[model samples]
Target chain A: MNFKNFITHTLLLLLLALIQIIFLKNLALFGVAFCFLYLLGILNLPIPISHVPLILLSFGLGLAVDVFYDTIGIHAASASLMGFLRPYWLKAISPTGGYDDSAKPNLPEMGIGWYISYSLPMIFAFSLVFFTADQWGTGGFFGVLNKSILSSIFTVVLAIIVQLLFFKRRREIR
Target chain B: MLRILQFLYSLRSFLLFVLLEVLAIGLIVSNNSPQGAAFFNSSNAVIGTVLKTRSDILDFFSFAQANETLILENALLLEQIKALKQEPDSLPIPLDSAFEAQFQFTGARVISNSLRFAQNHLTLNKGSKDGIKPGMGIFNQDGIVGRVKSVSENYAVAISLLNTGLLVSSKIKSTENFGSVNWDGINSKQAKMLYVPRHVKAQAGDTIVTSGYNAVFPEGIRIGVISVVNPASDPNYLDILIDLSTDFSRVNYVYLVENTQIVELDSLHKKSEVVNEF
Candidate 1:
């Protein structure tokens, strides 16, 4: 990524984290689903970013969230797992024609179908791990499953809205 | 050697993944341990400040409800005072000893509260500097809330009664049959009371009050009302559900009750246990 792109991504990540902590932290739908909008930062990274950096970035993002939520390492563990599996998920869902090198995996660039298919699994994976670790031993299996699924759906919907509203569609400069 | 190095390099991401996850698990395990205390919790300074600020903003919107609660509490206190004045010599022996003097109450605002989780906690604005400490009982006008878990300089974390880990010694006020109340982690508004004998007559709406068997709470403090009474699977006991008096969703202000004689009482109890061993 170029220096300008790096700077932009960093600022966007910070902004998303701030929004998650200040506004979205207390928000729950029907007292079950919760929005973890901070995941947008990790999900939208440039496809070419290396595995180590990606994992580190996700760990940092999760730790930032953990600090605010007072949840210790639960978010960090989930986000790290999500980051490690992102490349494999991308490969599994690669278009028949293959992905363009410069295009970012976002709603506008990847289209809604591809975006949902890609983001949903990633978010679900994160939520499953997050909730499992969070409610371990205390919550029954059904309780963990309930929280993970509901929270993932809530997060994904908010993420889609955020991407559609704020992320401008970039023109290919071929 | 070259082949092994190549294989290791190929699995670097997986290794990194495992390493980070292990580290994260380590943190969770360590922090949740009894010895971990509240170092990484909402009661810590940075998170506490943020939550306190948010609660302050939210508190503005609940002024009317808060006013109503205060008025009701004031009237109750006034009534007690009037009764005492009317019959000074006839005052209850417990009241004659200055019931208020044995406990010091510090008012606190709850900055962060969670009722959805299996184990829930409340972060209060009062802390060590405010004379708040672990083991202090917290209550509001409606009823008992919980015991303080840990305290920072300016913040304290209380284990909410809704938490499964907290068991309150309670009794049916009408019959004086004692039981212990604990959250089953299913409902936020209801808790289970155990150990009341199957033969004991308990009905829905019977008041449940603290037994004060544990010195954390003084006797006769209101806890809740029995909502459901059922025969336990074991014929020896009754399963009773209680509707908590404190509506945790709207509870913002609370009083931390510090018992002046707790230390002495605790020592006396320990001495009796030692004597029993002899």
Candidate 2:
């Protein structure tokens, strides 16, 4: 990535983290669904980003968010898991023509159908890990599953809306 | 050796993933203990300042309600003082050292709080600098809130009563039957009262208050009211649920109470080989 691109991505990440810590910290829909909008910061990175750096970046991002949430390691563990899974999931769901050198896995570039299929499972995995760790031996399996499913759906819907409203469309440039 | 080294290099990402996961789990385990001094939390200086700023703006909207509550509390205290006042001619009695106060109270604003998670916590604006210390009990006019888990220089984090991990030693005021009030992680407004025997007359509407057994809270601090009583799967105990009085959602201000003689009390318990569970 160019220096300008790097700077833009870094600022976007900081903005997302700030929004997450300040606005979304205590938010829960019906006391079960939680939105993790900050995941978009990692999810929107260029397709060719290597796995090692991607995982390290995700771990750092999660740890930063975790410090604010007072959930010391839960987010760090889950977000890194999502990061570890991202590359494989992307390859498995790649388009027949495959991705461009600078393709980003965002809604505007990947289209709604592709985006939902891509993000939903990844988010679901993230929510599962997060709630599992949060609830840890206290909640039953069904309770964790219930929270994970609802939270993933909630996060995905909000993430899509945010991308649509704020994220620039690359298709117009093409 | 060369082949093994090459294989390890090829699986570097997986190894790093495992290493990071293990480190994260280690943090989780260490941070879960009630007495553990956590390093990375909202109590850190930079994060605390940010949270305090956010609450400063948000607390403005709740100022009227907080003022109303404070006024009501002041009026109640005034009435108590009036009732206890002696005639001008009456001789003052000098109280002995036994009558000295054992708890110190400090007022603090809750800069950040979360109730949605199974393990909820609250961040207070006061810290060690303001005489806020770990193990101090927090409450408001509504009821008991939580216990201070860790304190930084300018901020403190308390494990909320709604957290599943915290257990407050309490009793039913009407029957004097004691139990531990624990969150079952289902409802934010309700918590489970454990170890109340099946035969104990723990009826609905019975008040639950701190028993002062653990010395974290003084006797008779309100916890909640019993909302549900049912037979448990374990025939020896009753399943009793309480409706927590503290409206955690809107808890912007809190009072911290530190037991002055807790060290002595704890050391006594240790000498007797007793575990203080709360």
Candidate 3:
């Protein structure tokens, strides 16, 4: 287990959460907004560091958000599943060891196309699960599906923007 | 069997996704029950505090409108008081059956209210400690808002007139003929009474008041007026639209009416549980 990678993952998740709470929540483009960017931190974590711990971490992060926002364990349950399934999906998608053991998933490290391919599916899966659970408590099946799709699309776009803008330029090495 | 087992193994993620989703649904459905609900509901102290704080922040913006409404209502009350002095022999109108039943006014402030939602609720700044109980009627000088639904130590939440779940028994002010009024969910200013029957002569301006068919509210408390009446919409019942007398978006101060006789009535009813049909 690389200590630097864990620290990077924690800092990134907290920063995304801060941005989501303070800024992006109030930002609406035609009433569609991104809020679950913090999931990227979990998604970007390297595989084989025991999936259970990461899933628990995602669950905790989601519960923290719910506590702040007054939704129940909806987000927590969704993110937990995403974290549990993370390793299996990573193995299935990237058999060539695309991600480094000591590194984070960024454009400079994995290239834009590999990053896009890797991140988009995880982003979709996680967002689909996260917003769907968030809605199930308040809204029924159709409502959950609608919010899941909209939030997932918005999340993916923002995830790419964050990838291209902040992490893309700051990379000192591949 | 091996092929089926392989298929099951391949589909484990999808099944797990569904299982998690069901857990959430189960949480919600179980929350509807009396006991299984407390775990994940807003009853949780942390969730309640968060919602309370967020609502408090949102309530700040509505203060200006609320103040203007209170001032207007106060001025109108003063005017009525002055007018009553000029015209004697007219006793001041009494409110609530609780007065007849010998209960007192429980003062409470509007903490939170939602107008635009399909289902709406209001939270008041008083609760069981202040003698506010569930099913106690809440009102201002103008008219009814709702009855308390849930109560805590220092606060209570109400199912408002704007709620789709609420079915209030009301009467036309002139005839006192009763009907059931509910929010149609399309308009905040309008509610509809479906089973009023077309036989009665209802006009566009007739006032509606509580009919006291139910114990929730006393008779003659104002609800709204018949703003639009389509008698021909259905043969048996008239389709009536009501313009609410009280602007809910502006309500602030309210009186929570508590009936002390309820305990006695409940005890008597419990004692008389076995009725002799003969």
RMSD of each candidate?
Answer: 3.3, 1.3, 6.8
What is the DockQ ranking, best to worst? Answer: 2, 1, 3
> Under CAPRI classification, how is model 2 graded?
high
Candidate 1 lDDT, tens digit per residue, B1-278?
A: 99999999999999999999998998887766645654477778888898888888888999898999899999999999987675656655545655557777789988888776666788899888988978899999889998898889999888889777688888899999988998887778999998888889999999999987777887899999999888857778998989999998888899888888888877997887743110
- For model 2, residues B1-278, the per-residue Cα lDDT tens digits are 99999999999999999999999999998899866769789999999999999999999999999999999999998999998899899999998977789999999999999999999999999999999989899999989999999999999999999899998999999888888999999999999999988889878999999998888888899999999899857779999989999899999889999999988888998899998665
Candidate 3 segments exceeding 4 Å error: A1-170, B1-23, B33-37, B40-62, B80-125, B137-147, B155-166, B171-210, B218-255, B264-278
Better candidate by lDDT, 2 or 3: 2
lDDT of 1 at A117: 94
Q: Residue A151 in candidate 2 has what lDDT?
A: 91
lDDT of 2 at B34: 69
Give, for candidate 3 chain B, the lowest lDDT window spanning 10 residues.
B34-43
Residue B211's C-alpha lDDT in candidate 3?
76
Two-chain DockQ for each candidate model: 0.60, 0.89, 0.17
**TM-score to true structure, per model:** 0.90, 0.98, 0.62
* Candidate 2 segments whose C-alpha is farther than 4 A from its true place: A172-174
Q: A32-122 in candidate 2: lDDT tens per residue?
A: 9999999989898888889999999999999999998989999999999999999999999999989987788899888999999999999
Categorize the docking of model 1. medium
